[model samples]
Target: MVGVMRSCLRSLLKLMNSIIGMVGTGMILYSLWMIRLWHQHLDGGGSISQIPWFIYTFLGLGISLCLITCSGHIAAETANGHCLSCYMVFVFLVVLLEAAVTADVFLNRNWEEDFPEDPTGRFEEFKKFVRSNFEMCKWIGSLIVAAQALSILLAMILRALGPDRGGYYDSDDDYTPARLPLLKPPVQQPPYAVDSHFKLKNDVWNTNR
Candidate 1:
């Protein structure tokens, strides 16, 4: 019954990892889109008035998350303890990075401060237009962070309650209580020797009678 439950848990964690992997891939694409837009709209006259570094950072986080998802699924399927441990650690870092990015994106929403040179009064218009997009991206980061946190939890749990392992080939042939060992057949006495001994004893008993 415990094995059955562990199997079910492995299935569920793999499914979640696959779904979150897709989400992480989408986030990477979104970060690329953000970079493109920042260049096309915010960069002008040899001055790039945008936060591209943060977007790049977010992209790295997304890639790490994707790797964790894929590796975690493989580890769960194989019941690999070391692989699972590494996955959990990397995912925890991803969660932290994503949470920081989300907080920075949502809290620091002052578009005018980011691009302070607005002579034609387009900053207000830009703010109104870009705020929604910013929020969307921020929510994406937040969601991924949440998912990664859950992935960490799942990985940790799997490390504890995963499955039976440690089976390996044995060279010796001693029986132990820890596990059943292969046994060899005992040596047999010759049938002729046994019959002669029994006949000699019978003749001695008959002569005495």
Candidate 2:
């Protein structure tokens, strides 16, 4: 029953990681598509410098997220302490960043002033979208934050559980005999040593004669 629960938790973690991977892949592909469109618009008349820096930021973020999710997958599969610890650290940092951004958005009235103006206008569009569907966005944002928290919790539980039983030994085999040390043969004593008293009496008699 415990094993079943652990397996379920591992599967859930993998599913979460897959979801994160898809999100990262989508971001990367979108950023690349935007870059391609921008290049076409330039038509050999403009340099790459004309491209918005936020696009590159998204690309970087996407790559980082993909790498982190890959680590998460490995951690879930192997249940290694080190891998899980590293995954948790990276995920915790990402969660922390998201939390900070959310806090700023809620607490600061001049938050928009802190961000650079988007040359692509996508940022403005995103803000408009969020405003239009604030409740949906709020629920989505909350779910994402909750998923990250749950992933961290699951990873901690897995790390505490250590590696799987199947990894070390077979369940059906009784390995006690195999693990036992080989027995050494008993030592044989020389005949003279066994009859030491007789030899000593003979020596005494010889000395007396």
TM-score of 1: 0.57
Stretch of 10 with least lDDT, candidate 1:
166-175
The list of candidate 1 runs beyond 4 A from truth reads 31-59, 105-130, 133-143, 165-185, 188-209
lDDT of 2 at 12: 93
Clashes of 1: 0
Task: Write model 2 residue lDDT over 55-127, tens digit each, in one string.
Answer: 7888888898899889999999888899999999999999999889889999999999988866766677768
lDDT, candidates in the order shown? 0.68, 0.84
The TM-scores of all predictions, comma-separated, are 0.57, 0.78
Q: Where in model 2 is the C-alpha error above 4 Å? A: 44-51, 172-174, 182-209
Top model by lDDT, which number? 2
